[model samples]
Target: MYSRALRPCLITFQVHGRHFSSTKQNNRRVTVIGAAGGIGQPLSLLLKQSDAITNLNLYDIVKHTPGVACDISHMNFPAKVTGFTGPDQLKDALRDAEVVIIPAGVPRKPGMTRDDLFNTNASVVRDVALAAAEVCPKALVGIITNPVNSCVPIYCEVMKKAGKLDPNRIFGISTLDLVRASAFIGQAKGLNPKTVNCPVVGGHSGVTIVPLISQCQPAVSFPQPELEKLTKRIQEAGTEVVQAKAGAGSATLSMAFAGARFAFALIRALNGESNVIECAYVMSDVQGTKYFASPLLIGRNGIEKNLGLGKLSDYEQQLVKAAIPELKANVATGEKFVK
Candidate 1:
């Protein structure tokens, strides 16, 4: 279990060394916007088990939100779980939520890009985001829909129009990329994957997802040929899972873990603990863009500090330079969708 009680400071949040107030203690509600799909199902399961969560709200456009809630309710977890289905009840589902995660959208098919999945998922995300603004404007919103490079902007546009947009309270969930990067790189290096904590920055998509290998903790080494092979593998890790599922699903289980880690950190921040830091995609002015993803100092209210891209190796620097075009395009795509 990740701890939500880590020392709360403006320190960069780490998944290690954390604790949560789980004993019928904290009375905060966590609502998952899309709690029925491949990612949402397992992601909801994880959240239901969170000590920081006293109540859990499951919302979905699919007709099965109630069933999903029924299914997850069997778990002997302490948190109260409720399901809200269809459009009419969306606002009610978000009521009084402290944390609202949007994992409610389409998953990628075998040959689909995140952008391809966005065409349908974008509308889905917007509708939920609109409800979030109306019912739980103060909630920390964690977005997990596809083409997050774009959907996050869609959420921002919704909240902005509703006049409830808070950059610090909003985040794009790119932790999966970081998880996959660490796992793939650790496997390539024959090291334990748990020991690898590679912070992936930039947007979430094909080339837009850039992993900063130079800054991997505990210091891992790969030769030139190995570096290229490993980087490609890390970059393409999602594809490996998608192909492995063979049309059954995308990377849901691992994404759930990453999402939980993020949630735990937020809970820790709320608990007034120190030294809780994690890399997440957030609205950033660290560079030229209105938003960028990097390591952030998450505090009680929202983002405490926007840690700019740290010093990268020559190879990593090259990746950052190469990724700008893709990142900018992805950001543009999301912005246009909202417009």
Candidate 2:
């Protein structure tokens, strides 16, 4: 996992039920599993800064979870931090959570495909999902675990078995894909990355990730060759980071930032903000795929509406067609995990 301790140089007001944001009045409980890992630690730190989180639970199989919680508790945020370790504490961690973000699982190593992580991560997600189903079935579950194409279905199937499946309440954190797509596209077009919005659809794996650069928010133009190349870059960006790490680990920092972005957006929506939107991989009939990533309007009850893939150019359409078979295989692989 991607856990290097970046300096905590954040600024805010004095603590004890006080925060800098005027809109920080929501008293929602947020739980993070895998709080000791690379992505988990930074993600926990980032979540600690959120005004929407009144209670933040950090749970991990690792014994150091409490230590991580203790570290984050000293921050100048209103959210009270608590740590829960191992299966014994999982129920407590999830007891009343309104949002659960699972980043638990092994990270990809050099030369390892996301599918190579299937067996290990599938079980991790299954256990977590079952726990969520048991204790907080209505929590907005955003999955940050890998092999997401497979893991999300595994989580959903477990919920389904428990008779607690709410397709709208479960989501795969495909925010990283959209984040990368927007940044890369913005860089290509000399636009502000923060202002760029690119809808990345399809699943969360290699070939399954489809970045619709043609539908970018600013309505920019790209030549066919450039578009094709940029799309490929976005699809393979995860692997690109993994390889660049040279066996250290996968893309933890960027993934944490993207995960936090998605979590905050969901929290805002849950807190009654209107028009909150983000791209997520979720169960969908969109494009006939059992699960697909698309832009979703998040509301009080999770996904208000799935804004299906808008308009794909001929090349984008070709990408979707090419991805279907592989995506179906991934879905089957996940659905088979419990059965």
- Top TM-score hit: 2
lDDT of each: 0.77, 0.85
**Model 1 over residues 5-114: C-alpha lDDT tens digits?**
11221123232323233323476788888788877888888777665677988988899899999989887766889999988989989998888888877788799888
Best by lDDT: 2
**Per-model TM-score on C-alpha atoms:** 0.91, 0.93
Model 1 spans > 4 angstroms off = 1-25
- Alpha-carbon lDDT of model 1: 0.77
Candidate 2 colliding pairs: 2-38, 3-38
Candidate 1 minimal-lDDT segment of 10 residues: 1-10
